[model samples]
Target: MTSTGSTIEPPTTRAMVGASVDQPDAGIARRRWMSVLKHAGLIALSVVMVYPLIWLVVSSFKPNEKIFSDLSIFTGDLTFENYLHGWTSQQLPFSVFLVNSSILVLGAIVGNLISCSLAAYAFARLRFWGRNAFFAIMLGTIMLPFHVVLVPQFVIFRELGWLETFLPLIVPKFLAADAFFIFLMVQFIRGLPKEIFEAARIDGAGQFRIYSQITLPLMVPALATTAIFTFIWTWGDFFGPLIYLRTRENFPVSIALKGFVDAQSSSDYGAMFAMSVVSLIPLFLAFLIGQRYLIKGFATTGIK
Candidate 1:
């Protein structure tokens, strides 16, 4: 429609403007739907992953006869006797294994934190001879399967008189034997600004001082990641404890869990499940506490 000799433009222009505005709203709506779908998939995957753990806890409360027989996690027959017997039936109380595991985990955490951080600091900050080659070798070790060196390592530990002791499990950690943690830390340390180290040195700070005061603080997320992983791995470690720990009294919670299985006659499935559930608590707590740092590092330090 025209007014006078010229066309009135507002209605057509308003229609175009409204169309343009609605375009973005449609795009946003599409994106929202996509986001919802993605989250739904993730939630489903999370439930799938957590299902076994849920089943484990639920099964712990169930009777042994009903453990495998009842496919459903929600069982009617529940008892605390499993926990009581599992805790006390062992030659020593369940507390002994818990205490043993605690000691091993504590030692490993301390060792890895001190050793891996130092190694990372050296690789990231302090430059010396053969640094690249050493770093390359350290990384190469990660590719080597643990089983390849398992026997040799065991023999070395045995020769060192570390058999039948926690040393076999704990000592290598203090020496930065786990290349994964070192690599993790090195990456995190590298992501830190070099200027901090320069400034620290400019202020007459020594290497140790710079490391302790500056890098350590800035590396909290990485360090926390290291500590959390170390605690979990050490706490759940069965191989090292199984190989070195000769007696039930010295066995960690992981090794102690085996005591419930008796092939000759009967296996205490209910009791075993109960103790396994109990064993998971410390790891859950540690992960819950340190998960923030793990997420922070993952977000900030991307393949760096």
Candidate 2:
């Protein structure tokens, strides 16, 4: 009887082991299938997202008649004439527009970095009176629609004789008018370990020294992120430039692109697409350069 019981136990143990093995295999098969579906979905989405860009690039190369007719982006007969035409057709040169845009973007970046960082440092590190109340007020401003203040802001700028100049666009950034950026930087600065600042203080470092030498270096990722955003915003600001810049010569690439589509004449789609591609180059380059820092910045920073 004992030998029979032992024999049955071995078979039962073998069955249990087989069941365990089968379960794991089933799980692994399901997981593998899920992974494949996920990757397939991502690839499909990527292709969809890139298709318009591919179409634009192809259309830029095609002649007027062939642009919509050509189905294949890769097989189109490319031409440089569209770019040349786009560049030379306007009275206010494309180069002039490019320079204006560059100056505006650079000024905005510099102003936002300096002003926002200072404001953020004060809010995060200092323990002054009504700090929390002030911060809440600042955050509240973000919820207010831009249209609510646009008329007042425009009137103020007009009263100050700031119309028809870049001053109206660039000056407010220096005053930390961009409360969102200030708030973003404040959250980032607050996330940093306090012990480091304390250690610097113990080593006889002043506030400016600590900020310049310690905090600034560690905050490069945040600064880069801010600069990238500011550059993109300033570069693509059509309404601001349209409102302030009276002269055709001061138009940015965004406003200049509109010149390709005139009201009276039939617009040249190929040239319009070509100019559109040209407008994207600077932004693409900016993102490529700062993408690494942007990723790192977002990883460490959050609202306090």
Candidate 3:
């Protein structure tokens, strides 16, 4: 104080220590609460979305009278009678429809993989006159709705004597009828390194040799994706079969499921629900088996 002096604040080590200790605790507490809230929200949404499917599965085991009377998912009484009756309730065994759907799906998968991939390869790798014009036209077809061509296609198939047959359903796939799949594969093929194709050309490899040996092997992700989607779409197709197939024997599961309903009499709700569950099995299995490839395909092809 005797000399010229300025005031100096004392260091509060206690306050600094308290703040440093409290900050970490506050941040960790906030993050933990946020995580808990996020998980709880997800679980709630999942329950809401899955409730209907659970109800359907439960109703399939209940007698028709009890289905509407008791809305609860659980009951003291349950029966397997619906499944037994549903398997044989129609004119033909349910197995017949399953087989028909399986055959159609198989054909569609093979056709899309072969024809669409080839078309995509040509559009992506091969050079020709008016290539861009042709590609533009193909993409334009993707924007066209299926219903716009339904009547014309029906007339053409009838003229070709393909009505009431699986030919109408399966043959179009062989002709690269699905433009969306072709587009998908084209994008995937374009992503491949061009150097490899040039090297193969230098080795005197023909287009077919290049496609079979080099391109096809690397296109597994795209091919598997195509197959899985083809199976799902063709298996669940009801309208196509309904228009062309008049005979019950030729009906796929999608159409045969309609047999459970009778306009003049009471509908077999229990059996219908049972068969509906059965129809979903193949779709579930296909997804589960090929989900990895599906994810990979989307990632490589830049499709969301």
Candidate 4:
């Protein structure tokens, strides 16, 4: 009712105020419910994933006769005799296997860090003829499954007289045979600021100097990630040692664990389980130690 006699509607400030207040509350409630569901689902998945490891550890403590029979993880029939028997029953002591595996993993960590990082640096930063083509070819090799070249690699190693030694297991790692680590490092390297390398170059620093000083220090997260994975892979590599190692004395823990298993004869389940648990210690320690770095690498690369 203005002086011009035109009808007008006033703004609903009360309704607007109510809506503004209520929408956030509704959104918050919805988000809270979603978060609850997400957390619950994650907890359930965690239990499911962890149950097998818990079962393995529990079975290690139980006697062979009671392992399958005792469904409960909290079985009262627990003993340390499995560890005693497992440690002593093999032709070579478990400590020998432990030492061999440790050496193998350490060698692999060093090899992958040196070889993969160098390859990644060359691909990511250095200029070279057919760089893109070479990178594409390198990436293409990942599509070629390991089984495809398994026989050829075996024959080559046999011809090179590396078949019966740790050389077969450790040498190719030094040659950057693992494309996965190279790709991972390349991703990490690509994320690094190129200005650092530029500044280093301006100061008359060589490629090696830039790599060692600028790149390597920043690539610690990626390298730790590589080390963790390399250790785990090398440690659990049953097939490699099985094929190359003839003597039981030189066998790593993966191969040594098979001593407890005789398909034709009575298998010592308790001992096998105990040794299996023991074998996982290095992997557990590796992941635990490098978990922060692993997270950092993945977070930076936006890859898991």
Candidate 1 structure quality by residue, lDDT tens digits, 155-243: 99889988888998888889999888888888888888888889889999999998898999998878888788788888988888888
What's the lDDT of the predicted structure labeled candidate 1? 0.83
Segments of candidate 2 deviating more than 4 angstroms: 1-20, 262-264, 296-304
Q: What tens-digit string does per-residue lDDT give for candidate 3 at 219-257? A: 888888889888888999988998999898898999888
lDDT by residue (tens digit), candidate 2, 14-124:
656436543556555766898999999999999999999888888887776778777678774878777877675667657888998998998899999999898889899
**Which stretches in model 1 have alpha-carbon errors above 4 Å?**
1-43, 262-264, 296-304
Q: List the residue pairs that clash in candidate 1.
A: none
lDDT of 4 at 228: 85
Question: How many clashing residue pairs appear in each of the predictions shown?
Answer: 0, 0, 0, 0
lDDT of 4 at 141: 78
The C-alpha stretches of model 3 lying farther than 4 A from their native spots are 1-22, 261-264, 296-304
lDDT on C-alpha atoms for all candidate structures: 0.83, 0.81, 0.86, 0.85
Candidate structures ordered by lDDT, highest first? 3, 4, 1, 2
Candidate No. with top lDDT = 3
TM for candidate 2 is 0.87
TM-scores for all candidates: the values are 0.83, 0.87, 0.87, 0.85
Question: Cα miss at 103, model 4 (Å)?
Answer: 1.6
- Candidate 3 local lDDT, residue 194: 95
* Candidate that scores best on TM-score: 3
